[model samples]
Target: MAVLQVLTTSVAVALLWVVVESIRRLFFHPISHIPGPRLAALTWWYEFYYDVVLPGKYIFKIQELHLEYGPILRITPDEIHINDVGFLDTVYTGLRDKYEYPLRALRVPGGVGATADAKLHKLRREALVPFFSKRNVLSLQHLVTEKVNQLSEIVASHAKEESQINLSDLFFAFSNEVRGEISGIMKVQSSGTDGKSDRNPTEKEAVYESVLLNESLPPQERTLTRLEQEGALLALAGTESPSLSLSIIFYHLLANPSILDRLRTQLETVPVDASWTQLEKLPYLMAVIEEGNRLSFGVTARIGRRAYEELIFTPSSYANTPGTGTPNTEKSYKIPARTPLSISTLSAHTAESVFPDPFTFDPERWLGESGRERKRFQMAFTKGSRKCLGIELSNAELCLVIAALVRSFEMTLYETDARDVSFEHDYQIAMPKMGSQGVRATVKFRV
Candidate 1:
């Protein structure tokens, strides 16, 4: 009876502590004044419900919260989410001392994407920057063009048969082949059956020729495992993002005929074998690419950054301010050190004030000087020091593949609709709705 009584007392004490902690978090914590659901403030289960239970819906939920509360909200007990587009530069730029939040759920140990230490990221990224530089990517244009031509031929063969093709699979395969060649995982002979010379040092070979050749670095940095990890990261990113963008672009283009007509008219002047530089000059094509990037939700996950020092944020627009009145330029808030802050790329991309008619896949919105200025808010590739390393390479691939495909063939959706292309879940990377065949289409060779 004494033992039973003791056990009952312990359980009662534990429940009391839980209640006290919940009350403190809800009403007395440092961020308690910030507007958010009481459950979110009290526990992490609130975020887990959206991120894990509902998959990628948290990004949209966050936007909803911002709409209800303000531009800023306490997303979790220890983290704050900012929905203001004006503050993107402040959060992502290199001018401020910022560190990536210590990766918890997505940590990959030694992988480049999982590297939370800013200094380490710099050192590792420096070795890769040269390989992915604009000059280097431009030089490798022929390699990308080769892959694009191959894809064009494959599509042409399908067009002859009037067979429906899964563009997602084709794009992913094309991206994989290009990435393999670049990383030296797959070697392409200098001369193919078509009598074209395709020679470029693989990323693996480049690293060996550049950094690995140096004997002064630590032994661990020279291991095959390290190089493989880097290559895996490149290959994974290289495959997924471009494929997603291509699928989404094709879905929108086929679904809208007038838009496709305009695009086709613009491409008529260019040769089927146009170079990346040539294709990039077409204003309409560039706009389409930008729009595609914006709509694809490139990285749907929230990117967290840690504050090493206190930072003050001042609202620049009424959308960023609390309530319905005009923004007060002088009103600001200081984020204390060690606090984790994040800005959703989806939220910024879909901001009604920023992108007006945010849900529409209208490429026209990206056309003129006004469009160019508005693109400053586009965060698909993100911004600042930690921006995607393969931006130039990815852009090159996108332009080359998109131009080649559009110029050489006419594509129409094969019994597919908007739902197939719509974002279904946030699996770290955005995924199309479940059971989607991924933008299947019928192709016809263009004269």
Candidate 2:
């Protein structure tokens, strides 16, 4: 009986502690003044419910909450989400640390992309920046051309056989194999795929010469295991975003025949064998790519940054969107230093104020004088010192591959619709609906 009484008292004390702590988080936390759902402020389970249980819906849910609460919202117990694009530079500027929550989730802590500290990230990134420079990346056009030919041949074979092809899967495969093999990128991307370490000493050294030979990195930072994590990070970046963008681009092209014809007419302005520079010069082609990047949204996840100092944020026109039906009130709020904050690509791309009818595949929005100014709003590749390093290479691939496929073949959608390529779920990269076989098409060699 005495033992039972002791156990009962312990349980009661624990429950009391929980209740008190909940109250403190709800009303007395440092960011208690920030307006958001009380349940979110009180616990992380609110975010986990959306991110895990519902599976990647927290990003969308956070936008909805922003409408009800205003521009600045406490998304989790410790994280803040700002829905205003005007605040993007402020949130992403300077040397800011990444929030470790999402970084840890990526499971590549040693990689530059996954490194959380701003200073450390700079160290790791700077060591390899020269290898990814535009001059160096453009020199890989020869490799890109080879891959494009291989991709074209695969599609051509399908066309000759009158077989239906899943372009989504095709592009995914093309991206993995073609784009992954560029430069010494092959070293980083293909490192552990076969689970063998039989590579020659020269091959092993060449794979990691940049980070491996850098005099700056500590001995601990250059471990084979850590470099493998870097490899994994590079593999994911090279594969996922390009394939997702390509699928979306071609799906939109096939779906809109007028757009396709317009693009084709533009392509005719240059030879079928036009170079990347010539293809990239065509205004319409550039616009289509811009639209593709907008829709693909690169990484749809909210990988927010931690501010180095306190920030004053005032709601802009982009905040409290029309669907929210909230009263327009532009008020400034002070965000504490070291707070985790983000303006996700979804919020930035689909902001009604910025891109009207944002969901539609309208390439015209990226045309003329307005289009040039609009480029500032493109955050599919996040800005700042930690921006994606593969932008130049990705753009080159998109231009070259899209030009070759469109000019070489006619692809009609087969047993596929927008849902196959739509941003239905956020798998860190945009994912379509469940059971999507991807954008399938019946192809014919264009004569």
Candidate 3:
């Protein structure tokens, strides 16, 4: 009876502690004044429920929260999310020292993308800059062309068989193979009389060898383990996002016949051997690519950063002057040092004011002088110093492979639903709805 009484007392004490802590978080926390769901203010489980339990739905939920609470809201107990377009440049760019939120589960310790310290990230990024430069990517055009041709041939074979091609898988394979070739993972013959001779060298051998061969690397940074880590990081970074974008682009093109015809008409002017440089110059084609990126939801999570020093955020007129102040003005809010903040690219890309009829797949929206101006708001590749290192390479692949596919075949959805191509979940990267067959299509080889 005494032991039972002690157990009851402990349970009562635990419940009391929880209630007191909840009260403090709701009423006394530094961010409590910033309006948000009461549960979110009290505990992180509110975020975990949407991001974890529902999977990618938090992105949509965030949009709904902005409708209820305003442009700025406490997304988590410790983090604030801004839904205004004007603040993206300020937050992602500039001379401020920013540290990514320390979610160790999402980070690969010691990897380039996971390097949180500003100085260290700079050093790591500098070591790889030469390999991913625009000049280097242009030099590697043949490698991209080769993979595109291979993908076309596979599509042709599938067309002949009348089989549905899983574009998601197809794009992923093409991306992986192209990365392999560019990184010199695939074998290449050297200048030698006997091709089998031991003296013959392969093309740079591996990305690790090429990157570390530079005399610029510090002695401590040249370790084999670091090379392996960076290589794995580059491989994943180089493939997934671009492949996902390609799948969505094709899905959109196939869904809209008139747009597909317009794209094909534009492509008819390009010679069979046209370079990506030339292809990139075609206005309508470029618009299609931009539209694809805008709709793709690339890296569709809130990329959070903590300030090493005080950070100031100024909201746009839409956010600041909602019947309470003058229109088309800005209001500044000073954020304390070490406060977590983020701008969701997914939200930014779909802002109705920035891109009118934001939900529609309209390549025409990306044309003309006004369209060019709106491109400034497109954060598909993100912005600032920590922007994607593989941007040039990814763009090259998107142009070459997409052009090749459109030029070589006519594609249509096969036993595929609209939801299959929709952005259903956010797993850091955007995912099509669950149970999706993954953008399947039938193809007919163009004569």
Best by TM-score: 2
Q: Write the per-residue lDDT of candidate 2 for residues 1-447, one digit (tens) a residue.
A: 999999999999999999999888888877778889989998889988898998888888987787678778998888899888888889887989999988777888888899999998988888777767777666667778998899999999999987899888888787774233333544644474432355433222233556766778898887767877877788788788888888898999999999999999999989888988888899999999999999999889897899889999888666646555343557788888998988899998998777878889999999999899788889877898888888887888999999999998998999988888778777788888989898889999988
List the candidates' TM-scores in order: 0.87, 0.91, 0.87
Give per-residue CA lDDT, model 3, range 120-146, as digits (tens).
778888877766788777877777888
Task: Indicate the TM-score of model 1.
Answer: 0.87
Ranking by TM-score: 2, 1, 3
RMSD over all Cα atoms, model 1? 4.8
- All models: lDDT? 0.74, 0.83, 0.75
State the lDDT at 404 in candidate 2: 93
- Candidate 3: C-alpha lDDT: 0.75
Report how far off residue 332 is in candidate 1 (Å): 3.3
Name the regions of candidate 3 deviating beyond 4 angstroms: 1-24, 95-103, 177-206, 318-332
Among these predictions, the greatest lDDT belongs to: 2
What candidate 2 gets wrong by more than 4 Å, as runs, is: 1-6, 177-207, 323-327
For residues 14-104, write the lDDT of model 1, one tens digit per residue.
9999999998998888777777888889888888899788866777788778767777789888788887778887777753333344344
lDDT assessment of candidate 2: 0.83
